[model samples]
Target: MPLASQPAGRRERNKQQKLDRITAAARELFAERGVDEVTTQEIADKADIGAGTLFLYAKTKGELLLLVQNSTYADALAQGKSEAASLADLLDAVMAILRPVVECNRKQIDNGRTYLREIIFGDPEEPHHRDAIGMTVQTEKAIAEVLQRDERVSADDAATLAHIVSAIMFVSMAATINIAKPVDEIVAEIKDQVRVLLPK
Candidate 1:
């Protein structure tokens, strides 16, 4: 049988499958080798595809890293939304959101720390800033709605209060810790901070 005998649709599907394989290989290499060290040719060899073909899917190694990071964050956010309800539920939900991002980015977060920091600091030309702001806005809106509906919270300052509290939680968790503490202890302190933001 001739190699060209394959149907056009099959060829396209096979090409897409190879691209998927390349993407997966790239992600693993990035995770292991760090974003700075991994090369497109290395990813291609790992995927058992030609280096030229890898370029068809990604222009550069940076794009592949971004793709992996974005997909990881999206999955985590979707899972967090599914598992959490109301402001009270967000403590764990926020943790859940961090979980996958942290897991997928273990090398970057643990060894580099720059990757996670970039998301927070953001680049003007990059979408990270907009994405972070949108995520925060959505979470704030949810918190604000919850506060407005709660008898213990004042409706007048619901949105403001929500944003303030949410910012505090995110900052506090991401902040540099002089002394490492248990997760529960940290959450307890954060919960106290949340209480401070709420009406007495």
Candidate 2:
């Protein structure tokens, strides 16, 4: 029985190792060249795995991008949440929760836009897409917590405002008209819109 369990444990480790390699390879390639410019074959080669194995992890390039971006997005959200904890001002706390996200999204502009498209239009049933959606939910939850810092804002209104803020952030990042804008400009635009929505 112990031997049987050992084999299972070893298989699980092997799977996780492959996934880590795939994620690292995809991240490096996507950063060097946008998602549109990187090929699946190149990712597999970089990961030291075959194309067939790659598909077993992420069936499409969009899925692969989600797999990579989701990790970074989660990190940014965690960082923002930590920073927001110390900020007493509502606007500053909210921006603390948002600034890192915008920075993460703009790291590679095309890749960022593609990740947003995948989250919005990709099949939610797909594992990577689901993970990406989960990240968005976590982000909204973090923002809502910050909004609630204002004693005048009810929990319900805070939630509604958080959802709206999420939409604004996504749109600002995805809009083609802002493609040439720097990260600071994009973040500033989002801040301006959010400032309007906050209660006086």
Candidate 3:
């Protein structure tokens, strides 16, 4: 029988199981050792799968990195969109999304700060590396549409504002939260900044 003719249910189940295992393992490894330090073989070992299985799920470590980044971004934005009203409301929306992610994975985030920093401020040419660039553009465009509806900003200005907000979010993620200056205080500061930026 040809591969296409073979039963798909079992294959699908096995594929899902493998994906679950890999994703779980990657989360654990990322939480424990950070993203840069983890290798595909190590991830496979943690997931109890072969190196080949790792590639089946993610073609490269970069793809897996993108997966993690996108998931985090999507969750933040979804939460933000649901909760925001004004620009300050939007800041609160963003902070709500970020606080938990940062608190839960503070160590991992600190460890991976360099990678996150590079992602935000590094060369624009890096987007040529993957489809994330396009996805990011889409996200910014969506935000721009929202802004255009609420304010008098031009389309280009709206998109640029979205990018600036995105940059601020990145900076917040990179910051260290401590007793001297708590996350709430930082968030309030961000909210104040947004108020200044948004038109009356």
Candidate 4:
């Protein structure tokens, strides 16, 4: 068989190895120092990659955060969807979907705030910003799928509902944290506000 016909395991492994090196270096540095304090050159040196190469993975420190949080966010979304699958009600499904988001944000609330600010208000010209936008859209699509499972919600309506629900959850979580409100109160208040937006 030709080399072209072979499985791409080697290629994939190499890519994974590089990514692992970068992520491992980032984890150690970010943990020991913190995001704001860690310089890109330091991370690049630790990863054994050139400074220019590091930018290929993440253009800015905030984007580097997006890179680090990528796996965690994906895992949270996966778990949220899985749990939401067990519940039939729209509200329950929505809450299940967002609960993980809240928990993930709480992991490093300072980073969370910066992450939100950068992604939410970032320039669209940046690649990482585009990725963040894409992630949000995908999350909303997942929510729409759940809501659409209900007979009462038309396919078209589901998209709108998902947008509303996602925005509500996003804003709610940010507010709850910033105001020093009891974190425990977020879920209940979100449920109330969502119920208000979507009358049952």
Instruction: Name the best candidate (by TM-score).
Output: 2
Error of 4 at 22 (Å): 1.5
Residue pairs in collision within model 1: none
Candidate 3 lDDT, 1-200, residue by residue in tens: 99888777987889888887887887777767777788989989989999987887777665565545555555655555555434444445445544443443244554346445545544454432244455456556655656676557888887787787656645665665532455566566555665566656
Ten-residue stretch with the least lDDT total in model 3:
98-107
Candidate 1 differs from the real structure by a C-alpha RMSD in angstroms, to one decimal, of 7.0
Q: Which lDDT value does model 3 have at 40?
A: 89
TM-score for each predicted model, relative to the true structure = 0.56, 0.95, 0.66, 0.83
Model 4 lDDT tens row, 97-172: 8778767765665666666777788777777677777778878888888888877888888889889887876787
lDDT of 3: 0.61
lDDT of 4 at 124: 78
lDDT of 2 at 38: 93
lDDT of each: 0.60, 0.95, 0.61, 0.77
Off by over 4 Å in 3: 1-9, 59-62, 85-107, 111-135, 175-182
Poorest 10 consecutive residues of model 2 by lDDT? Answer: 1-10
Error of 1 at 181 (Å): 5.1
User: Which structure is stronger by TM-score: 1 or 4?
Assistant: 4
